[model samples]
Target: MTDDSIYHVDGDLVPASEATVSVDDRGFRYGDAAFETMRAYGGTIFAWGDHLERLERTCEALSLAHGLDASDLRTRIDETLAANDLADASIRLSITRGVQPGKLTPQPEVDPTVVVYANPLPRGGLEGESVWDGPATVETVETRRVPDEALPAAAKTHNYLNGTLARAELEGDADEALMCDREGRLAEGATSNLWFVRDGEVHTPTTDGPVLPGITRRIVLELALEAGVPVREGRYEPADVLAADEAFLTNRTWELRPIATIDGHEIGGGPITARLSRLYDERVEHACYR
Candidate 1:
């Protein structure tokens, strides 16, 4: 795709290449911003409500001014999608602390910057050929997740250096990186929530701490509950994940991705994951297409 796509920056709609942000913008300077990644199917954003809810919470926690509600966000997204002639796309909405004149402090009256843009979804699904096209291989990198004391994982802020560093360790050999918490307990993947299956039961980390309460992850849990699939959540170690029969990752763009191996150790069969995957796909189909 060319840089010809249209994007919404603040109150103006401009070409992607022409959308300029100030050098002094907090988002550009200190990563003082919040964002949401969404998927659009046939011009309709899937899970828009859930994404907006999380974004509002993030804004509140960061003391960033939020100018748009869900309805406003939907209208702006529709406008961008139409201008770009995009029906199936991956959408990103970013809100920043805005530009502070002379120094680092944000003035109370400064308006927050809002940007919304859409890019063509890859071949099969939103981001690329369905993440399910093949099994993934992951590595447990040395980088650990930022502790809740330092930065709450639930906030979807622009400060993602931790994940960036962890993913860099892959160097293209592994499909993804699984990060552990400060205490050496399995936390999550570089960009997705994690899950593991063992003895026909599903296991994942609790959202009370250390994990981004992903919208997709929430749906998976709901589906598991409905399907009568056994589910467990708590602190788990890498050894527990490595010993599982199967493992998977979930995110807004990629609904589900199965892990075939972790640190080169082959994961066993995926009976539990298979069932949940089917249910998750059906749920998405209904939500996005119906």
Candidate 2:
């Protein structure tokens, strides 16, 4: 997809300039919407099934008006990619609370607003300031990640003002921020899931924690277990991560990325991290969408 790629607004295919939603939509007023960022490769999406399931779950979590099903969203992605004449691109599918007139209530009379667009994303520059395969450093920022008590962090809703500001709180400490909950327990990265390599095993927080249960994080767990590497799901303290062999963050675009530092201390990218990274690559190498 190029800058000129069109957007599939509702059921019509229109140019990016021609697509627009109402300004007074509840999605704008109450931050009521659920969305997902999906990565595509080799004519197939990475974790396509998982992403869809998560999308369905997000809609269920937020109670958004569903006008299109998962199958229809997939077809829209295919059509948008074809219109752009690109084989690989990142797609965004957002279902707002629909364009309703009432500011107090958001029950819409027209169809729910479904927007799908694609953007051309390159292979990226790795972390912030490292060679392609080199490691990145993370630091604990000042802002605390909101616990599930206030707002359900599990739902990928539009209520991201806190997360957005927390990102700014990481200004110069390190390349990125690893957020901790109010109880001072490791939650997750500002935008990704957390994984620590220690004693030849990979440790991550369980679903009971407030983490988003990322699709890539789930993939890493499967990879670890399939490779005969121990994968445990439980609460891992910040101290445990510091004492571990290595640490990494998982997300869709880059999959598993190594972290060389946390909270100002240099971390070692041990053999275990290398083994997991390399083995996972070899296992999913065939899924590359190039």
**Among all candidates shown, the one with the greatest TM-score:** 1
The positional error of residue 16 in candidate 2, measured at the CA in angstroms, is 3.1
lDDT per residue as tens, model 2, 1-290:
55666998887789998888888776777778888888765456667788878877877776665767778888988888788876556788887877676666656343667888887654321111222355667877777888787777778877777667767877564566788778788888877888887777888877677788888787778778887889888876789899987888877765667888887787757777777667655544456622
Give stretches of model 2 more than 4 Å off.
Answer: 102-105, 108-110, 122-134, 288-290
lDDT, model 2, position 255 = 61
TM-score for each of the candidates: 0.93, 0.87
Candidate 1, position 290, lDDT:
63
What residue pairs are clashing in model 1?
Answer: none
